[model samples]
Target: MENTSCCIYTFSPYIFLNAYGGLHGGAVAAVAEMVSIACARTVVSKDKDLFLGELSMSYLFAAPRNAEVIVDASVVRSGRNVTAVTVEFRLGESGGVVYTAKATFYNMPVASL
Candidate 1:
């Protein structure tokens, strides 16, 4: 299957904001994971199972509430047992990068039952 290279996410006030009224770190991490998995799924064969092995993120700026953010994820490396993806979160349109993440996924063949 062809993988989607990028997607847009809109932060809801209730779901994405922290008590301080900024985008929550955990929420950002979750989105990074989702995007990385989506990118990894594009390159793997149908029978192979992909699992997230490691995820790391750097927060460069605070994301504003109720804004549309762009998430771009791409496969940086694909190997026999592992795939690495990099994801970036940017504010609407030309806004600066708010966060960046790297995710590693382990690719394993599914055992037939």
Candidate 2:
């Protein structure tokens, strides 16, 4: 209920570091998916069934520990039966993009009886 077609969430998740002392990829993907769903819901109707059909995630740089992350998700397109959302994760301090993700959701109409 925050925005009509976009959602901006800021949080600092516990940095789960990888073996190379970088932020874990799974954590970024998980957060992106959660944000994407929220963004898609803003555009999708309540009566329709929305499902995440596709999600693409990319890691741009290594995020340091104790860094705040800003997640911005926006609905790129909303059609009669589908919606697309784009998500980006940026470091709050340096404002560098650490991860980016895109999601596609399928909106299914209610069955006619």
Candidate 3:
């Protein structure tokens, strides 16, 4: 509950696009990573730094221009040295799942606080 985040993302031409005029894969991954990190940070200590260890994404459907998508990110587990998060993207109107991602981050302690 406390480790979750939800936002609406509107696809625009300003963002990268794929050959099919849908959101680019890299752009999708970037959005997923950003949201996941925010979710993970809710439980992670500020003195530590999060290094993205792994990110896995699945693009289920195409999100075209001007399409609004609901992005949801949640922390699965936040350990002392690792944090795991899951992100989902769905069409805002139809609620069809468009993308899914899972990311794992390694927590490294800062030398000075």
TM-score each candidate: 0.85, 0.89, 0.86
Q: For residues 2-113, what per-residue lDDT tens digits would candidate 1 score against the true structure?
A: 2346444544443568887778999899989987887788787878999899999999988776766778888888888998888888887567899999999999999989
Model 2: residues with Cα > 4 Å off, grouped in runs: 1-5
Task: Summarize candidate 3's per-residue lDDT along 12-57 as a digit string, tens digits.
Answer: 4445788888888998999999888877888888889999999999
What local distance difference test score does each model get? 0.81, 0.85, 0.83
- Candidate 1 lDDT for residue 4: 42
Which scores higher on lDDT, 1 or 3? 3
**Which of the numbered candidates is closest to the native, going by highest lDDT?**
2
- Model 2 over residues 1-113: C-alpha lDDT tens digits? 23244777887656588988778899888889999998888778889998899999988897877778888998888898888888988899888898999899999999989
* Candidate with maximal TM-score: 2
Candidate 3 stretches greater than 4 Å from native:
1-14
User: Pairs clashing in candidate 3?
Assistant: none
Worst 10 residues of 3 by lDDT: 6-15
Backbone clashes for every candidate come to: 0, 0, 0
